[model samples]
Target: MTMTVRDLRPDVRADAEGFSDTRRLALPYMLSTPESVVHTLTHAHPDAHFGQLIAEEEGEIVGTAQISVAHDSPEPGQGSANIYVRPDRTRRGAGSLLLRTAEERLAALGVRKLFAWVLDEPDNRAFAERRGFRASRSAYFLRLDLAAGMLPPRQDPPAGVELRTGADFADDPRPMFELDAVTSSDEPSDIAVEFTDYEAWLEETWQHPLLNLGLTSVAVVDGRPAAFSAAYTDGGTRYATAMTGTAREFRGRGLAKLAKNDSLHRARAAGYTEAFTGNDTGNGPMIAINKWFGYEVCATEVRYVRELG
Candidate 1:
């Protein structure tokens, strides 16, 4: 069967569905849906130059790729192209074709450095290595059976601290944004990011379709948002932690754990049966916290970098 690569048509619902379906099948631990796919494409920052591509084989989608420039990063000429082929459709050249097309598009936009996330499987690593990509860092995908696992019992906040839902900041989310910015900057990653644009955060993060504000928990210290666990639900049984972190000044106080535990409990009460999250391999603190909540490592992915001349 002959395979061809093309850009995803945002106006076409089937295209979004196919892209989301392929992603979910390829990376089950991560959450993806038609609505979330479309939302990402439409709300992406203009400077990001984001584009989604699909590989089709005789009218059937066999692979997908999301390519974009790291516009928000202070460093220039850095971009990313993440490609995934259906497990059953491997060896058909769909993954290669999609990646080639993505690289060409990003290169045309003056991107000199390209980054990708490849599953830690031998074949996946080999495929990327053959394309001049070098492994940089790794991260693990974790899963928890919310319906069957034993979650740590919720604990009361210590004196001078209060627990609240993300929804509590609906009228004014600037504090949430501030806390997210500080916490995210501290996350371990090969590519450093700074969330400085409040308006962009409002459009891309706060207003995201998958974000479940009611299920998200925040730890407030003296009326200030200090730590939080942002929740994302698929409108079904799957729940995922989008981001969990504590402000630098409040790191040792266990506020992050407190917030995440509350959010997990809320997710269970709301009927989500499964929970998922990811942590960089070097982030031992977060990994330990997830293990305490009964989350087990389900899969691992290696970050790869390639320099284009």
Candidate 2:
């Protein structure tokens, strides 16, 4: 049976649902919903040229790929193609076909380097290696049972510190943006990124369908956002902390921990039963912080990179 690869249609609800289902089954730790999938498709930056692909066999969607350039990076011509096939449907030609199509699309766009994330399992790792991708950084996916887990006792912010939700800055989110810029710069990654475009950030991050401003906790110091725990939800019960960080000057004050803890508390109160987050394996402090909140490492993925001539 021949497998076919084609672009995903955001307007098609079935396509979005199938894409989301395949992603969730292939990567149980990451949060992917139909709405989030569509949001990404609609709001992708022009430079990124983001595209989603689905592999079909016998009219069934079995594999998916999210292809895009690293437009935010200062370096040009770098792209990423993250492909995943339904666990039960692997060993079929769907995965290979999807990846080939994605690579072709990216290469045509002048992409000189390609990156991918492969599960830290033998078959997944071998697949990437066979395709010329070399292992890079590794990250862990963590899960917390919000309903049953016991979080660290909430602590009062020290003097001059205040807690606010992301919604508080709805009228003027510049401070939050600045804080995000500073914190994101410190993130561990292969591609260095700078969040310099405020308008783009508003459209891509702040107004994203999955971002729950009401539950995203921010730590304020001297009337400015000093730390934040960005929250994302499925509009159902699952909650994920998309990013949690403190400004460089605010480090050691536990502001990030405070913000994340508050967000987790709010998430549980709102009936979100499961919480998820990811951290680079080298991010020891963050791993320790999540462990403090009863989060357990559920899965691991290794980043792989390939040079395209």
Top model number, TM-score: 1
lDDT of the structure predicted as candidate 1: 0.94
User: Could you tell me the lDDT of residue 85 within candidate 1?
Assistant: 91
What is candidate 2's TM-score against the reference?
0.98
lDDT of 2: 0.93
For residue 21, model 2's alpha carbon misses the true position, in angstroms, by 1.1
Candidate 1 residue pairs that clash: none
| Candidate 1 residue lDDT tens string, 177-242 | 999998888899877899989999999999999999999999999899999999999989999999
**Relative to the unseen true structure, what is the C-alpha lDDT of residue 43 in candidate 1, on a scale of 0 to 100?**
91
**In candidate 2, where is summed lDDT lowest over 10 consecutive residues?**
27-36
lDDT of 1 at 275: 99
Q: What CA RMSD would you report for each candidate? A: 0.7, 0.9
Alpha-carbon TM-score of each model against the true structure: 0.99, 0.98
